[model samples]
Target: MSTPQLLMIEDDARLAQMVGEYLTQSGFGFHHALDGASGLEMLQQRSPDLVILDLMLPDTDGLEVCRRIRAMPSNALAKVSVLMLTAKGDPMDRIIGLEIGADDYLPKPFEPRELLARIRAVLRRRGEGGSDAAPAAVMRFGTLEIDRNARTVTVGGMAADLTSYQFDLLVAMAERAGRVLTRDQIMEAVRGRELEAFDRSIDVHMGRIRAAIEVDAKNPKRILTVRGVGYVFAKQQD
Candidate 1:
């Protein structure tokens, strides 16, 4: 396997330098962009395996940058792994980041080792930062179709826009069909990690999925919540 390439978009020159050097020594190929605009330009040009994006950038907002990447029509660019760096302690920022398709994040003034660990975790969750594995099989339910091999989903024969994480969550639930999975189970299956206390991240992602899959997101029929329990995929499709 080739070394994973990483792009870091940070306006703090000194901090970026230190972190870049550290990540390089830690076995990743590093590219540094000083602001969001240049970073996004580099993103289009290089398409790194993962991005280390700081929330505050000189030319643009970090959140907007993430949104732009996730909005790309190209599957490869839209699904690229992102690990956010922010100085804010607000949980809202983290929630927003995840909602915008960031794979993970670390609040600023963090240890470089922790950043390294997060990078690895995000990459692992993104199927070792790259996957050429054969798609398992096709799953069909009414107008909804999931092509595991292609990692594509379509509703009514039209392609549905979904982030990589959203797709994983949908597949995990759809595979189980009638099972009512707890939060821990769902998190474990999709993220390979347990849910944290007071972590509503799963719910946020679930809403995103519903909007993409359900004809009426306000009255979702596919993935239904089980009150105190987690959620369940409808076994019987109309």
Candidate 2:
């Protein structure tokens, strides 16, 4: 298998250099762009497997960059996994990033080891960074179809746009259809990380997933929320 390539769009040159070295030593091909524009161009040219986007950029904000990536004309590029880097202690920034389609986020001033772990987790959900293998399986519920091999979800034969993390979250819930899972349980199932108190990242991703698969995101039918609980995937859907 080819080495996974990562693009880091960070304006902090020293930090980027250090991270590039660390990731490169850890068996990844690393590339760097000082600003969002150059990073977007590099994304098209290099087609890296994942991107580490910094929230504060010299040219444009990371939120706009993530939006542009999701809006790209090329589906492959648009769907490429994104792991954002946000300011430490800023939950709002992370929430906004996730809402706009980032696969995951790591706060600044973090240990390099934690960053590495987050990257591996994001890629593992996308079925790239892990060595474990499983047979491809397809799950169907009414008009919704989830193809595990292709890592795709479709509704009534039309493809649903979902980020890598969101896709895994949907699969985890679908696998346990009709069972209510708390936000921590859901995040643990997909991300293997405990959620911080008051963290609403799971809610953000769930909203995005509903928007992709539900005919009416406002009144979701496929994934239902249990007040004072978590969420449950409907066993029967149309």
> Which structure among the candidates has the greatest lDDT?
2
lDDT score, candidate 1: 0.86
Query: How close to the true structure is residue 82 of candidate 1, measured as C-alpha lDDT?
Result: 86
Estimate, for each residue in 78-177, the C-alpha lDDT of model 1 and write its tens digit: 8888889999978889899988888777888999998987888677656665545735899999999998778889999988877667788899999999
The lDDT per prediction is 0.86, 0.91
**Per-candidate TM vs. native?**
0.90, 0.97
lDDT of 1 at 193: 38
Pairing residues by index, what is the TM-score of model 2? 0.97
Residue-level lDDT for 92 in candidate 1: 89
lDDT of 2 at 231: 100
**Candidate 2 local lDDT, 1-238, one digit each (tens):** 8899999999999999999999999999999999999999999999999999999998899999999999999998999999999885778888999999998888888888898888888888888886576449999999999998889999999999999899999999999999999888898777655567888988999999999999999999999999999999999877
- For model 2, give the RMSD to the true fold: 1.2
Runs of candidate 2 exceeding 4 Å displacement: none
Clashing pairs in 2: none
